[model samples]
Target: MSRELSTRANNVERLPSIPDNDTNLIFGEASVRYSKGRLLGFVTDEYIRAVRSQRKSIDGFFKALRELNSNDAKSLLYMKNSLDDNSHKNIAFDNDDYKNLLIEYLKDHPDPLQEYNDLIYYKIKNNLPEKYLDWFKKDLRCSLFLAFLVKKSIENDVYKGRDELLEEVVDYLRYDIEIFNSDYSQNLPHYRWDIMKSGERKTADILYIKSYYLKNRLDCDKNISWVKPTDNEQINWMYNYLDDKDRKYIILKGMFFPQTINEKYELILASLDVLSNVESPDIGTKDKKGFSLRNYTLYSMKKAWDGRKQYEANNFLNENSSVKVTKENQPKLKKLMKFSGFTANKVINHSIEQLYDELIVDKKND
Candidate 1:
């Protein structure tokens, strides 16, 4: 038992002591040492006066130091054993100068992706240079990162003052959609379209919706089918009911015709009109006046039309005389058709012919 105890003591004494040198340190300690050393040598000091006096010489030194090999840097970095509080105090004073020098070096050597990552890390650690946080969020690495930054800003309530930056990000996302239109073949418009439809950006959303709606309308005018206010008994009933409801005033001209045409047109037009009118209204006005009616109406209309379009495009293959549309003219339509399991070419000719017929009828009436 005594021998065992002695052996254990011997093992304990044999345990390695931590190296005092930075070069032989573990990663965590090395990081701390590096940060502390940077703070001491470059961050604080009469270094500011020295830097001003020998600005060119200091820049040359920094350039040389930056260019040094790994072994040389490790040797020089490990040379310092300890730092005093006065060193820290001096670092605090020289913080701006150090930051400016780093910024100039980074600017002259532009690496957007890496620089963005470094800025984020530094901002999280040192809490220096409040402007760095703003710049980090604005850096255009990926839409995913911008989205994360936006969400984080929202959580921190930093979004209020950063509206311009948010706008820039949204614009970048818009451009990305345009550039990579084919990659989103499954839900091509749905990605950017839904973002706009959320009513987050009133002007931008309205403009996009209007643009998409017009483009779709031009693609398959036959599919459009404007209901003519004929002498049909059912048509008269719907017209009277819609008119008496005081909702007819909100309907665009020629939007309330026959059941087949009126159904989709009224659905789309009503949604757009209501959404356009009520979006971003005053809070009291939105609540007290019940502008939420428009909001709900728009939502329901969008859902109904979207679902119906999907259903029609899906069962189109089983139908006798259905038409298929192409990507260039009706990109979203093709996606909807493909999602619905319709053969691509089956609907093209028939759909185009139907659209042409509708145009003829529309021109005659007009």
Candidate 2:
């Protein structure tokens, strides 16, 4: 996942999967099906943003879809059309069969894994003339893209403009991302199927899928607390030791001011040491389900940092240019306090007579 998250921005346009022939790599990755699902998710997200305004324009849609699919199925994502882009394309509509095909495919196959696998199986079963399952993938790409786009757009409350609503019914992805719901997805490597079955496991691809998919997961909401730190070291820390999804919470709920990478690293290391130390308050601590250990540690760091000024104020006295209480005189003051015991009071009154002698000598000299 660290490797995957680190290289995402460059690969947004070029999703990579290992050659199916490479069993070691396949077994070394996330579920191949899941990796493919992430790729399909990306493609659809882009296409959705592009042609969301049209439903009846199946020809134009497929042309656009084919254009996307044709481009190595890993098309470059030029994110066009924000809330401001108004130059909607005028594409001709017809091809009921094409429209029906997409609608039916989307209705039947929920994820790209199924969409991709079904065609692959079909190509194998029938001994189809197609040499590469690649052709079938191209055909289904439109449907897959549309399916996810329709769902995502709805989930984000993004409908087409006033001229945007239409007959095409969108099945929105649930607000609570279903991926995290899976036991295996939440806990990786340990739960991955290949590792359990065989010693040499494959899960790099899964990490990539999860990493890439997470980038666009909350595209719809601006108010969400997903703090995506682009720093490679930070991302590596998250993917390696912490859950990527908990980033928002573990990072002081995005409340912490930015620190240099070295500072963050040091703080995290310090916090971890404190948590593990038997004498520390964090020794037996357990954060609530939603609140993470990192979150607790980060707040503790803040708390400690905040209390420092107060600590110095109470423990150290500064007399600001009056007769300075040097280390030499401090012991004298303490001895005076001890000798006087507050009853005689005379012991306290004399600055041991030294200061009076010095002042009188100075006056006589003057």
Candidate 3:
């Protein structure tokens, strides 16, 4: 990331680029897509976003959308047989099926996405018709649920009660399923559980609500622990701060980088973190909520490197410098401690006395 190394690092693999003008060179497919999205105002700004692997996140949304589009009745439900109440396989669902479906996509894919797949599934169950989908209500519910979690994230991790947090989720989902049956979430009817007793509950596989029902289904004095995978966009954002790639690359190929225009530099994602950065530079901005647009300027090795650091310093510096990923997450925690320099929490932190002044402040604003 040092400015001095930009020349060699910019096109280390001898990758080609496309000249957009006297200055910029489109590096990869992502850069191309990002350029278009940003030019049109789809992307908010150029900064290191909280998605470590934009490709994976992009693919997840695509797969989720595809899953929603599938007319296959069986695909809609993960058959009750596929998941058992207390069985080992049921408790630990086969994540591989879902994981594979979300990989192999280019990072700055032009495809749209929705992180609320599970939340949406909770709304209508498996009732998405072959056409005429209404995204308004489900989007609202997702927004509310997301806002609640964001508020929780800012709270002191200690004072937070466990079940109270979950109760809020169930309360939202349990509000009569018909609440989302309309095109507008604001138009939802009053909270009610028994709108129609005989209505089909097939799509009622809503997570927290399902947990809410488990208690009613069992007569024994048992405490049901409803566990849901942490795939929420917020959680993934947190993960990106620690899990980002150690280095970014800029080798370009494909149509964007050809012949005479192949040597230009474009500022894509977080260049210091991951490469194989394309116009959708292996290093570019990726907001999980919308377009993974790559922002750029006239090409220059120094310019690209500086722009990349400027962005990273603003968005990801604190998360990268504050925690003990080197200690806690590392097997060397105890042994590294003997050196007297090791200090911090399990993640990018358990504590922060030794954290640098840079980690806590939002440098972009100041």
> Quick one: best lDDT, which candidate?
1
Error in Å for residue 113 of model 2: 21
User: All candidates' TM-scores?
Assistant: 0.20, 0.19, 0.18
Off by over 4 Å in 1: 1-22, 25-298, 301-303, 310-366
* RMSD versus native structure for model 2: 23.3
Cα lDDT tens digits for candidate 1, 157-179: 22222333344445333223232
lDDT value, residue 365 of candidate 2: 86
Q: How many angstroms is residue 309 displaced in model 3 relative to the true structure, after the best TM-score fit?
A: 17
What TM-score number comes out for model 3?
A: 0.18
> Could you give candidate 2's per-residue lDDT for residues 151-173 as a string of tens digits?
33334333332112221221111
Sequence-dependent TM-score of model 2: 0.19
Residue by residue across 237-300, what tens digits does model 3's lDDT show? 2223323463223211111221111112110111111211123334333532221221121122
Please tell me which model should have the higher lDDT, number 1 or number 2.
1
At residue 139, candidate 2 shows an lDDT of: 29
Between the candidate structures 1 and 3, which one is better when assessed by lDDT?
Answer: 1
